[model samples]
Target: MMVKVDRLSYNFGPHWVLKDISFSLDKGEFLFLTGHSGAGKTTLLRLLYGALPVNRGRAQVAGYELNKLKKRQIPQLRRKVGVVFQDFKILPRRTVFDNVAMALEVRGMPRPHLERRVRAIVRAMGLETKSYSICERLSGGEQQRVAIARSMVANPELILADEPTGNLDFDLTMHLMDIFKQFHTYGTSVIMATHSREVLDCVPEARILHLQDGRIVTDSEPGLEEDVQ
Candidate 1:
């Protein structure tokens, strides 16, 4: 399994954000997290990627025991699990190539290999011409693509994305969806948090986990009628 959660829960001070969530994702499987804002989708993704410490319960992501994971071990876990933030955390001052290449550089990859790998993913994202352009000058959609490219450049075993296509237009959203599907075809496990119906339709094979108040409600409610936005 690429990810496993058993009775997982989290809290923010006195307010509980997640309540006894449980699910497992097999290796090479693609899963979608659908929920309205504040449904705890972002918080759940944060716990899986080690951004937030597991406040309660158990979670194993890309082979790391998250609840027991040490601070020093976070970098190791991250190398095996790629994350695309909802905020697009790429450096604004850095060029597109620099932002994407940073992932491999942190791993001490050789210059020749890093350049080839970064360029390939950049081209896939349709940012080949902007590879040398500063990210601050790019539009929101372009910056979002930069974040996606950076997350995939390292070829991690699992990818966790938070609304990757939120800022893109219909045509660009479909284009980016194709790129995601291509990577899934290569056997990379993916757990994407999204509210777009078009995005869900694009990956009909993916298992949908609808989160309502941090609980998986799809099993009890087979009707699955919440708009998905």
Candidate 2:
């Protein structure tokens, strides 16, 4: 499995955000975290990616024990997980190409290779023309694509997205989901947090895990109910 969580729990000060949550995902599996607001979907993803400490239980990603890995080990772990946020985090002053290429640069990819990889991802995200344009100049959907390009350029084994398609129209939303599906096809495990039933209906084959008030209430995937048991 690419991810494993056992009896995981988290609290934000006086509020218990996640309680006794447990789930696992195999390599290349695509799953959805669906829930209403404040249901802990974001918190769960943060735990899996090691952004937040697993305050009450065990969690592992790509075989690195979250609780045991050292601070220096975090960079290695993050290299295996690509995170896409609902808000585009690209630097407004930088060009699209520069924004996407920053990840490769941080990982110390050589100049020529960084250019090649960033261009490939930008093209894949349908932002080839916008590559040299400043990020602040792009439209909302285009900016979102830049964020996706940045996330995917790393080619991480696990892709974690928080509301990747939250603010787009139907067409753009489908386009983004198709990009995620491409990542899944390339053997990257994908877990996305979304509340839209429309998104679920668009991708009916994806395993759906419903989170309600920090607990998983339903898990549905054709012929996989037995696996859950």
Candidate 3:
């Protein structure tokens, strides 16, 4: 399994944010986590990426036991997982190339190799012309593309995207989603948190995991119903 969660629950201070969440994702599978705001979609994604600890139940991602993952092992785990946040998270002072090359640079990748990889991903994202442009000067859609390119430049085995298309228009959202689909087709497991009906409609064959009050109420595929407690 690429991801596994059993009887998982999380709390912030005294408030329970997730309750007995359980599910599993396989390699190359695309999963859509759907729920209203505060339904714990972000929390769940964080847990998978090791941004938060797992204390209540078992949670495994990319073969690492999240509950037992050590601090030193986090960087290794992160190198294999890409995350796209709702807030672009690109450094305003950095150029598009720099933002995307940061991850490779941290890995000590040589300049020639790093540049090639970054340029490839930038071109793939349709931001070839903006490779040297400052990130802050780009439009919302362009910034979002830069963010996606940054997340994907290192070729992570799994991707966790939180409302990646929330700020994009119809055409841009579809375009970005198609890029994600290409990644999925290449065998990367993807878990995206989205509330957009259009996004759901676009990937009808993808697994749908619906959360309500932090609990998974449904785990089904398109045209098929499965009740998950």
* Candidate closest to the true structure, highest lDDT: 1
Off by over 4 Å in 2: 222-229
* Tens digit per residue, CA lDDT, model 1, 120-156: 9999999999999999999988999999999999999
Per-residue C-alpha lDDT of model 3 across residues 1-229, encoded as one tens digit per residue: 8999999999999989999999999999999998878899999998888888999999999989998999999998999999998754899989999999998998899999999999999988889999899999999889988888989988899999998998789987888889899999899999999988788777777998989888988888955744322
Q: Let me know the TM-score candidate 1 reaches against the reference structure.
A: 0.95
The local distance difference test score of model 1 is: 0.90
Instruction: Give candidate 2's TM-score.
Output: 0.92
Sort the candidates on TM-score, descending order.
1, 3, 2
Backbone clashes, candidate 3: 0
Residue-wise C-alpha lDDT for candidate 2, range 61-169, written one tens digit per residue: 9999998878888888988899988743789899999899988988999999899899888988778898899999999888888888888898999999998887688
TM-score: which candidate is best?
A: 1
Cα lDDT listed for each candidate: 0.90, 0.85, 0.89
